[model samples]
Target: MNVIEMKTPKFLVGIETRTQNSLEIKGEGKIPALWNQFFNFFKIDKKISSDIYAIYSNYESDENGQYDYFIGYEIANPDKYLNGDSYVVKQIEVGTYSVISPINKISENVAYSTWQKIWRMNAKQLGGERLFHTDFEVYTNDKKNGQQSLVNIYLSLKK
Candidate 1:
């Protein structure tokens, strides 16, 4: 494993909306189910792809649990609105991030371990107080195609 120090720029992504107020800083729970709930609440036709991209807070813990962060998913077209919706869509700005690339089955462990590695590297971590600036996981395979997947988990940092 390699720990790289990078001064990352800001980035944007498209996301599905969610009804529940619970924010998922870590990708611990079922993702597909969450997406289903988001789509159902928005009443938008489900997209064919099974991927979701959004901006979120980053947190690290000893027990490997959820973090206290507020996340707003990026919608494709902010101008377009669904019925019965009163929430406003906005763009989330993430400052810097530590991108961790790991293989499929070992992604979770790898992500946490990478945080430790970062801690050891003499750089400042998010430190659990303020919400993480950015966090994301990249899946490089399709479940339907039976292809091997590689997940790259990224943790955003403070400047």
Candidate 2:
């Protein structure tokens, strides 16, 4: 794990989808469907970045195991790409983040296991309070065929 500061001056423009479920339910099946739509849009639009991101924000949970989650990719330009319906823009605040690099490439299981390990770590050992406002996973575009890739998971930290 490493600590780094990132400046996100531009908007993250992409399609948005919501899921209401418990953490135990792992309703991440919607993610791949979103990605499929994104890629298809990318092929036709040719305006978005190939680098994908899965952003988890607006976290809310109740005693009955219900929560809300948003997932999308970073777009190159919002004004041109945003359709004002399914596609939307989110302005990310610049701040410090605790970055975790998974040992193996990011797959469904790897992402789940990595988050499990992160949740199990001691708070003091984590070096900062987890700011649940905006935690995200970055998937770069340089992945080689059949080769394992490293994923950087950025956890927002309280300033």
Task: Give candidate 2's whole-model lDDT.
Answer: 0.64
Q: List, residue by residue over 1-159, the lDDT tens digit for candidate 2.
A: 888888764367666566543434465546567667776873325435555567776756321333333445565566765565756677566898888877756666787678778877665656687777777777774446564555678887888
Off by over 4 Å in 1: 1-50, 58-76, 82-90, 104-131, 140-146
- Lowest lDDT 10-mer window, candidate 1? 12-21
Return the clash pairs for model 1, or none.
Answer: 15-74, 58-132
Question: What is candidate 1's lDDT per residue for 81-105, written digit by digit as tens?
Answer: 4333444343435344556554445
Q: Against the true structure, what is every candidate's RMSD? A: 7.4, 3.5
lDDT of 1 at 135: 60
| lDDT, candidates in the order shown | 0.43, 0.64
| Count of clashing pairs, candidate 1 | 2
